[model samples]
Target: MKRKISTLLTFLILSLLIIPSSLAHDDQAKHDADLMCVFWGDDKVSLSSEEKIAFKIIANAAAITIDQYSLNPNGRIKEGTFNEIQEGLKYFGLPELSINFNDIDLNIKVSNDGKNISPNTHRLYTHLGWNYKKHPNNDFWKKRKHVLIDSVNRLLFNSKKIFSWFPWASDVVYPPSEQCDAFCAIIYYVHIIGDHIAGDTADKLKNIEPLIHYTSMDTPGIIVELKEQLQIVFQEQKNSYTFFELDQKLSDLTISIEKNCDILGFIDTAEKCKKNQEHAEQLLQILSKHLPTLLKNESFFKSRFK
Candidate 1:
């Protein structure tokens, strides 16, 4: 039973392999928040009367880039708030200004999934819990590799541990079809974890409209409460196929999305697509965990990805 549960988790772990161990970020992606605080809060950096107004305009323009991937990439005006940023830069005669914004700084000391992810999206998956040790050597990196595994235990096994980051739901927040690429990992948790029970309590998994419909993430108690519900699947074995079905659905959806979805840019290198691709690989690998017969069925499973 323990081994089966471990195998089940491996499917989830496989999906996370795409996320890099940690992203080398300058701590950007406030989702695109104005970095005014960086300069405004600095006591030593005083602005002149004229510079202050220019700063305000620049700050306002910069704020638009927070958490926004487009507003600016490569330190140049290309995407989201380009026009506004251009105006601010031109207004201040600061075309050469190196403004840093839209950095959410995901220094991922841990992955939300069961194991450490691929290095590509490491920063996207978590923040750094780096120990302030005198020796930050190979031993440190090696130890840090278990970040995702530790997260799995804390999230699923531990009852008292508190989570630091929110599982960013790409489907709800930025569905690849319309907004961004299909970079959703939260659904993996929702589908896999949500497949536990079968009665009135099981209704939560079947109907996630209420939880996903929340306008503000401030009251995300449901997400936390679901941890208790996770215990159901860990103990129950009858619903193992639920994991496979939900995982397989992802493959079908990906094919449909690629053929019909409205993608904004390139899908190959797009971070979101990269995430979705890796997650798909994990699902395909699960065709042999414990339940080899049902999963091995040629008709039941058809994931033909490159």
Candidate 2:
């Protein structure tokens, strides 16, 4: 017998928020799947560990309806129109119910004014296409309804750019800080991952050349690794890094940083304002702990490609 809607939905919500990779990893078919991890500098939620958990939970909840609406833009569901925002959310295979956008604890700001956030004082639900009659110019609603999911998703998950810990808001200007060094380190880590994924015969590492430039320019020699291993991943093409091997290599690299945070180049007072070393330490911790768990999840790995 099939599980009830509530049971199925709980699983979907949990998988989407808590462990996307874990569930995908269990699927043997997706074992060889490869997707580069996404990253971003601004337009992302960067905060402490506890804060991230809360952000993911609420963000996912708040965007559920949008995700569903985007997939089926032609019309409403079932025999009725989408009257409730919760109803739209439920269409995304969510078994439970509608979510309150107000509960999302985030610091998103308007791109233009930089003072306002969505789903909060903005009341995103009311603007959705469900209340089509409310809008005189229905094109705005039509466009928004179609791309709602991705607009939100990009703020959280971006594969095109390297992720950063730098605090950003539209209005706030950040001074030169250690976060730059930390970002440099992560870029090199991604570069090395790209090297292995590309293998020796191919010259695909060019994709990360920009990353390499930024890392070397920012911290100069921050990627402290054994010369032999460096050549293996970079110079040698025959030895391509498989996912498990890549995970092990990434683990080693992060652990190396934990052992020596100086690889982040934080001795100088130039960018020495705040949290550079401390943030680098945090990155090492994330790589050592969080990254390993994420890599092990086959589904999450593939989603990176998607």
Candidate 3:
């Protein structure tokens, strides 16, 4: 009887141990499956190390500018547009201008002048494009776009040129701009780029040659990753109700690029700065819509470090 009791006790203990171990193993397996499911559906595809880093930098700047624009709209100046020049200064941590143009003391003596308008003030007003009496011309808008594009293009190119000239000169300028009111324009560019380009064109912009390139060149590998991600996304939703919506977004970008570049006709209104910005934005939007698929690609996660 004692021997029988001993055998029964041992069997009960073993069964308890085995059951818990099996349950634990099953739980772990379920957890891993859940992780894989999310990984395949939520992440963007992998980017090359170089492209990843550059994209991060540009993306960070673009995000900040976009967020600020959404919140403040016409930041600083209440009229006209946001100044991109100022945004660049702020991005680089520069101090704000202490002297307001209205408050500045312009010591001018009027000597029998029929027009009492001082030359300095007149010039300042004209340059600021605040004169409502002047006929609205394309020159002012083009000039504003020109100044802003130069500032952004310089910021992007300056890093490469300086590094090429002197590898030791690696002080990357933050919020780089050439004008005091440049931030507004910078914000506008970021907004447009994010809206139109899908943010992937940043990859192509990096390969451009000297003096002609508008932004830094990123690795082509990154483009591959983006294209792969976009493909997966488009394929997954090719027949969905939202496919039409995504196609419309792509169409909008195409239209914007064509208009900015004057691809439809011989429009003399094509300015490189404006067109470049429009191009950048268009690329951003195109890439953005497919970001979910890229980020979630199973292969992307598996090969992220590789």
The numbered model that scores best in lDDT is 3
Point out the higher-scoring one by lDDT: 1 or 3: 3
lDDT of 2: 0.29
> Which of the two, 2 or 3, has more TM-score?
3
Give the TM-score of each candidate. Answer: 0.20, 0.22, 0.24
What TM value does model 3 have? 0.24
lDDT measured at residue 164 in model 2 versus the true structure, 0 to 100: 19
lDDT by residue for model 3 over 58-142, one digit each (tens)?
3232222222111121222111112223233233333222222222211222112323333222222222221123312333333
lDDT of every model, 2 decimals:
0.27, 0.29, 0.31
Error of 1 at 163 (Å): 25
lDDT, ranked from best to worst = 3, 2, 1
- Write the residue-wise lDDT of candidate 1 on 113-212 in tens digits: 4343333333222211111122213343323322222222212222122322222221123212210011012212222221211112222122221121
Q: By TM-score, rank the candidates, best first.
A: 3, 2, 1
Sequence-dependent TM-score of model 1: 0.20
Error of 2 at 16 (Å): 22
Poorest stretch of ten by lDDT in candidate 1 = 178-187
Better of 1 and 2 by TM-score: 2
